[model samples]
Target: MGRLFWKFFFFIWLAQLTTIAAVSTTFWLEHRAQEERLAQLGRNPPPSPELRPDGRPFPPGRFLRPGGPPRPGFPFVPVVPLVATLLASLIFAALLAWYFSKPIRNLRSAFEAVVNGDLAVRLGPVMGKRSDELADLGRNFDRMASHLSTLIDGQRRLLHDVSHELRSPLARLQAAIGLARQQPEKLESSLGRIERESERMDKLVGELLTLSRLEAGVMGAMDETISMDELVSDVVADARFEAEYIGRTVQYSGRGEALVKGNAELLHRALENVVRNALRHTPEGGMVALEVHLDASGNDVRFAVLDQGPGVPEKELNAIFEPFMRGESSQYNDGHGLGLAIARRVVEAHGGRIRAANRAGGGLCVEIVLPATCG
Candidate 1:
């Protein structure tokens, strides 16, 4: 990069030098042309003595006299505009070159940062609005850096989540089988517990695989159209049934025909995860309400599932959508913490966004927004 910078800077300097040299040569040629014109007029020695054979133009005027000796040929360069314009052009070129190279310098420093392992390094303001090819290159570099950072972060999260989640199941299995060998009476219960833990691990792995497939553009082949309103309504109905089975109720309010394109099973799973997550936190008789809003153009729809339960903290709002990020409130929850993460992945696969927030009325609100298909 430094070599490139020096090469680039020298190229500009050499260009300016070449231009100035050309102008100066033109100036000198024009000067010679004027002198040649004088010669052609037979005035090469300039007007000769109108008066004396003396070296003085007139009666040798004293140096202190008011009327001086023939005022020496206006003491000027041969080609005034050429000389002035050449100097002016050189100065203008130098200044313009410096102004243009400022961004390249910033870009050089930013490259140094990236070389030194700083993924966050970005070009300075000089590069942002430049109307040249370099500006586009700088923007593209920033975008590449951004995506690399995101991919690295995602990999880190994946490693951490997978490691932690696997430990529990492996440990449980080892313990269960170990104990089953010694005590026959506890064998069945221990085996059952082992099976349960193994199922949870399988579920987590499945969700991770689904996330990977979604990122790999797997949904590009799936064909399913779902109504956003009915989608939410069905998930809420299931949650309500489960809640009532456990002595709780879910309140649902929504419009109809909020249509979208997506894999119905995946969409159902995303909504079910959200509704079930809300119901899991609330107590008996607590209410979970569903709201569906269609865009005025009906080209989009939003589903908001709100629950009257202890909402997650503000700082955890964004993190909760990330895989394995169990909020402070969910520290004791029994399930693996992939529900919201999977919900986000599914929604995003269909070109949408999902966000969690604290409702004003003391609860959590998970909003899913999806693009709708036009009739």
Candidate 2:
């Protein structure tokens, strides 16, 4: 009933009508030629009819018009059959047009709904079981809509979480200010509390900005060929200083020189985050192991961190990489829970993957794999 339907209908109908008209013309012309030949033969009668061997009269010509039974009609077209064919073609053309345009109409309507902010609108159910290009198109539209819905939902949730996380520190800062006003003797301690809260807020904001840039795919270019061995050694050295401060230790091992191409700063932060996270979870006096090596295939560099800590639940393994997702344990309740998330984003931006698995001997193992470069 739309313009597309009408266009399809008109073109299809015109094609059928033209074909019928051409065939009808050809039959009419052939009939006229036959009549002319018959009339010519009638003008010069075939000498007298030829006689048969048994003395019975025989038609001199196969089509002996003058002697044969009379011809039926003049214009020579079977009007009934021709009219029936035209009607049938019209019906078939209309049906075919409707069949093709119906799915398209559904697609248009679904797109309009999406434009109107209805991201949940879909076309798969409306498309039926058609096994054609249009059906494939409908499936693609459904996938796109689903992706957009997920992204928008994630953005809303991230905003809410950000607001919630900021509120806590802001409230703490206000309380610290109030306490300082009430107790001049404790002003120094109160100011230290405010300073600590301010620093935490600053760190949180910085991580958030980094995550946003990574999600937007605008974190500078990955054009440097970084030495993984050196990077791991540097991170381990820094982690050890902190680990020893808390009666914990970080042990590092390297197989060989593994090279990768990426932004060194981001990669360094990612490695440091993973290492520090393990350190934080491991019980004091327990050692966190950080190892770097090339995989068996030799095409990828792997960084594995193992800690003697309570492993994450099976269901929460993947969720731990989401921003502000912390473990239920009191130890995990300290930080803002953005380190692993930021690490994940940086690793993924550099064409790498990160995963966590429960260690066999009652611990958690975090691994990052990056494509190795020859440089």
What are the Cα lDDT values of the candidates? 0.76, 0.89
Q: List the residue pairs that clash in candidate 1.
A: none
Best by lDDT: 2
lDDT of 1 by residue, 69-121 (tens): 23224223447765776577666656666666667777777878878878897
What's model 2's TM-score?
0.89
lDDT of 2: 0.89
**Model 1: residue 256 alpha-carbon error in angstroms:** 3.3
Off by over 4 Å in 2: 29-73, 328-330
| Local accuracy of candidate 2 as per-residue lDDT tens digits, 145-251 | 99999999888988998999999999999999999999999999999999999999999999899888888898787899999988898899999999999889988
lDDT value, residue 61 of candidate 1: 24
Q: State the local distance difference test value for candidate 1.
A: 0.76
Q: Residue-pair clashes per candidate, as listed? A: 0, 0
Q: Candidates' TM-scores?
A: 0.75, 0.89
